[model samples]
Target: MIPAGRTPATVERAAEIFGKSFNYFQNQRLWEKLFPATIKAFHRAGAQRIVRLWDEEQLLALAAQRELPFDQQDIPVLPVADPQHPKPAEYQDEDLLDVVEAWEALHEAGSKITQRAWNTYVSRADDARETSAPAPDLEINGSRFWYRKTLLDWDKTRMGRGESPNAGRKKGSKDTTGPRIRPTAIARLAAAEGLLRALPNLPQAEMVKAIATTQNVTDRQALRILHEARANLGLPAPSPTEKK
Candidate 1:
């Protein structure tokens, strides 16, 4: 129901702004980025009355509920140009819930993105690309996707060309392949492993040395990997040794 005393133009404008805000509210954790866009959208829709709905107190309260960062104490309120234009006391709670539910349902059918994980997946792709010719072939066995063979193909192709598996390209260009790390990619490898089989059975010194050689990393880098692996595996970290 439209608020009492609001003109038809005001109600229409509010509805338009509300429509654009569905996607932003779906990821409740991303309210910081979404809130400002919502305020701007309201302004663009000529719903200056609804702009008061985004004051600092309400924003901070919403942020607190989501455990998000919102440090602004004062948000500048836009002036209402027409004195006779009616402003609602507050937004209707029922209407807001309806839109939020619709957004959640929409996202549930699409990507289950609570936060943007593109960089994380891209990092995984780069690691797999290190040893494969083409990118890791996407294989779906039931619900699981495997890329082990694709990585092997990448490695073979690079060797055939006499180029290193992870060759560097010029900056600012698209890097569809993956990241090029020095010999010190052991830590990343260890991180990918699960706690159950992540660690090998060996003395601390020998284990570090073995990883260093196999991963083509420095002994120091290997030690760092061991530290991280142990932490991930719930094992006690080895004492740091002096560099002789």
Candidate 2:
């Protein structure tokens, strides 16, 4: 008998308790034959791997019948649900908002996002969808829509992080006057600095070009930042005619 509220176990764990290799279970297709109902596949959050879970009590029963050397205390319990996994919220047709409606909703929710800015974000989200990135909750008849809860949740998270609820500006936009740089650019800047240090012999011009290409900055701006970075590292500036 299956225990109530029993957590599922991974097939790998089940195979171990049954004193059988995973290949043995797969080759014989024992899961299909003996416990088809107990088999389930779950996709972990933000991962491509599919985890196969099984009913633990059923596996233990079969193991006991076969006299497999298994201890009930040693069985590993896999969590039934991932806390980070996104759950689809219950929503109705009235809760869905088209781009214009979503923009208005954002404004009403104190987002301070202009319609023009909102449209830019929508375009970016559409482009991102092509690469399997996050996008609107729904698209139909050439219109994109998001659930009210989804938009609100996104705004809440942004506000919680002390960032503006408005979506990020376009790449290379002339808006560097902000006090804080975007987190991703900061990370990439750090990486570029590390590369600079590791390859000190590399020409500053070449390094500047690389940083400009990666960070979407102009060569002049890249050169300025590179000079500051080198100075911080106690390295001398390369002359304009320096070929090394």
Candidate 3:
């Protein structure tokens, strides 16, 4: 029997499967096997790899058809059900094999979500869109900022050990090996507002350098944000830095 006092979100989540593609696959394949599992993977090393790997036109075409041949691996896909979930109450002895068979059929059809692709997707997980959204969330950016502040409260020598002073986990390796850093927007706007607290404020060239070295977010994404800020927020456009 389902838990009686589940959280509201948990109950809602149980009702809707996020599986848009793989759900379609299961009913079509008539999966039959002893035990079946579905998994997803991501690759995160480079942007060019992201662009080169996925053909948008092909994906759109595949979606419109709704009859995906399982062997097509280039498309991004996810399974409908959590593979590790407990079998339903009606799963009798003979019928259990059917689930395994389904896993085999789906496996053969070629919709495996590889580990590399999953890692890549996670690497591109931007926190900005999350913060600006309606729902309340523990803002990852805000968490990091607070963590940084707690480090400064400790002695200079204690802070250098690279531990999260408040949270007690080791600080990210970058926190130690790299130069002190701040947000790109903070750096860009600080000159105009005269708040350089705990960060470097450089000339135009170094402003660009600070963006490249400290922020490490993609320039294309930054440019998009710049335009949106200018139009929507009424902030002036930041001029491109002449390459030094």
**Local lDDT at 107 for model 3:** 37
Model 1 per-residue lDDT tens digits across residues 1-244? 1122222222223223434343444334233454543222211134223322232333433444434443453333333322223233332222221112222322433534222332233335445643322432221111111232322223234432214434444445487486555333544556323322644545677776776787677888777777777776677654456222
| Backbone clashes in model 1 | 7
Q: Model 3 shows how many backbone clashes?
A: 24
Which candidate number would show the highest TM-score if scored against the true structure?
Answer: 2
- Report the lDDT tens digits of candidate 3 across residue range 1-244: 1111111111122112223344443444312221122221111133232211112233343344435444543443322132224244422222111112223322333535334432342345345321111112122211111121121222122222233222322556445665444354554444323322233233434444444444464555444433443454454444465323
Q: Whose lDDT is greatest here?
A: 2
The full ranking of all candidates by TM-score, starting with the best, is 2, 1, 3
Ten residues in sequence with the least summed lDDT for candidate 1: 136-145
TM-score for each of the candidates: 0.23, 0.42, 0.19
lDDT of each: 0.38, 0.56, 0.30
The sequence of per-residue lDDT tens digits that candidate 2 reaches over residues 1-244 is 0122444466677778777798997678666655433233332233333345555665676565544333322333423332122123422223545566566667867886568766766667444432221367655334455666676766555432233322355456587677555565555567567867789788776898888888778988777767767766777767768734
Pairs that clash in candidate 1: 131-154, 131-155, 132-153, 132-154, 132-155, 133-153, 133-154
